[model samples]
Target: MSKVVLITGGSSGIGKSIGEFLTQKGFIVYGTSRNPENYPDSQFSLLPLDVKDVKTIEKTVSTIIEKEGKIDVVINNAGAGITGPIEETPEAEIKANFETNFYGPINVIKTVLPQMRIQNSGLIINITSIAGYMGLPYRAIYSASKGALELVTEAFRMELKGFNINMTNVAPGDFATNIAAGRYHVPLNEVSPYLKPYGNTLDLMNAHVDSGSDPNMMAKAIFKIMNTKNPKVHYKVGAFMQKFSIVLKRILPDTVYEKLLMNHYKL
Candidate 1:
């Protein structure tokens, strides 16, 4: 039987690419967006979903299950980004980022776990980031959010092992996406010292994102993990150095790894 797959935050970017790719590969793909009216119709089903809303998530999943029978794979691709100094970030902004990036995935995972456990087989893929492995300068909240999700994914993989459910945290480095347009900015006051430095840092980050390789690369990695009988716990998708950075973090000392990152960002 074809796999029934559900992907969140599929309005555009890597999530959308993954959905389109999976559809071509014959998976029964259902991708979610906050507004289904704007979702581009395709072989993949576009359903209304806002990861932050538990009811919407529950309803969307149930709707899919009622039609597709079972969800074989759940991809937590929905995310939010924030750019600014941690100190200047508003409480509401921080909460919003966590709600969408971290808690959102948890909501999806918990909602699907029972059904997956009963099926005795399923895959849960979370779209983390290279930033998750290490905290970045301006994108403090975004990095923290992804890092939290990655840790959660790791813990759940072990806990769900007995049920034959697998988890893969795909830590993508950079890809051309509209994330910058949606990223929240921490309001700065006239006396704020982080103003200029924050602007410079954000510019550098945007340049890096613009230069990022195609999102399709990440999509291919997702497909690989989905098809593999025994997939690894973590997968990094990006340029050579980006993937290497993860390895470097594991082997290099904290100070050394951080210095390397700082130098790369010209900080």
Candidate 2:
């Protein structure tokens, strides 16, 4: 039987690539986007979905289950990024980031768990980031959001072990995607004096993103993980720097890591 997979935020970037890749592999792929009209008809089904909307998520899952009978995989790949210092970030902006990046995936997981538990077979992949493992300057809120997701991924992985629900978190570092261009930013009109110091920092981060690894590489890595009989709890993908970042986190003391990161960004 063809596996039925639902990917949130599948209109573009890594989500879109995953959807396309899986479709080629003979899986029935259904991708979610806030605006389905924006996506043309193709092998992958594009459904309307906004991760922030709980009611819509429930409805979408119910519809897919009714039509397809079962969902074999649910990839919580929908997320947003907000770049700036925590102090400079507005409360509402931070809350919005969490709603989309953290709570959105949590909502989808809760909605799908019952069906997955009953079937006794399923895979849940959360698209986290290297930021989840280590903090970077000017991305305080975004890092925190991914960090929360990382915790959720581990908690659910342990809890669902008995039920045979496979859970994996893919943490990609600096992929070349619309993420940098589409990142949510506060209007300059709303910027306060305190945020001025971090303007240069955000610019530098943006530049790095522009030169990051290709999104297709991350997509391929995801495909490989999905095919594994026993997927790892966490998978990191990117250029050498990203892999090294994980090693640094493991070997270096907090103080030393902080200094190294600060120097890298010239902070």
Candidate 3:
């Protein structure tokens, strides 16, 4: 029997790529977007779901279960990107980022756990970020939001272990996607102290995404994880340095690591 898979934020970018790949592999793939109508040519089903809205999430999950009878895999791929200096970033924007990146995934997981538990087996993959491993300048909120989800996944794995519902985080580095266009960027202020560094960092971030690896790479990585009988709690897919940065953080002294990051970002 083909396993049914649900991918949030499936309309485009990594989610769409993953959905298309899994569909090609014979999985019953369903992807979610706030506006499903926009994608008329998607390879798999595109359902309406807003991760920030629990009501919409509940509805989407209910619709999926009704149609498929069981959901074997769920990829929490829906997340928002926010870029701004912490001090200059509005309080509302920070909270909004968390609502979509952290609380959103948690709610989706919460809604699906009961169905998964009843089925006796399931897999939940949270799409995190390489940035989540460390605080990135001007993107502190985005880092915090994804980092919080990473930690939550750690706890969730242990909590759900006995029930056979495997949960893990897949942290990706820069991927060529429309994420740069979708991000909420705090406007560069003329007189703010962070204007120079923040603007430069934003440009660099955008350039990285423009030259980043294909999203299909993420698709292949996710497909592999799904096939594994026992997936590890954390898997990272990205450029060598991006993945290695995590290692560097672990081994380097606090100030040294900070300096490295500051130097790289030219702060």
Which candidate number maximizes lDDT? 3
lDDT of 3 by residue, 1-267 (tens): 999999999999999999999999999999999999999999999999999899999998999899889999999999999998898888999999999999999999999999999999999999999999999999899999999999999999999989999999999999999999999999999999998999999999999999999999999999999999999989999899999999999999989999999999999
Model 3 / residue 94 / CA error / Å: 0.4
Whole-structure CA lDDT of model 2: 0.87
Provide the overall lDDT of each model, using Cα atoms, as 2-decimal numbers: 0.89, 0.87, 0.95
Which portions of model 2 miss their true places by more than 4 Å? 41-43, 186-197
For model 1, how does the per-residue alpha-carbon lDDT over 133-221 read when each residue is reduced to its tens digit?
88888888999999999898889889998999999899998888888788887765568898777777778888888998899998899
Question: Each model's RMSD to truth, in Å?
Answer: 1.4, 1.8, 0.6
Candidate with maximal TM-score:
3
Give candidate 2's TM-score.
Answer: 0.94
Better of 2 and 3 by lDDT: 3
- Pairs of residues at least 3 apart in sequence or in different chains that clash in candidate 3: none
Would you list the rank order by TM-score, best first?
A: 3, 1, 2
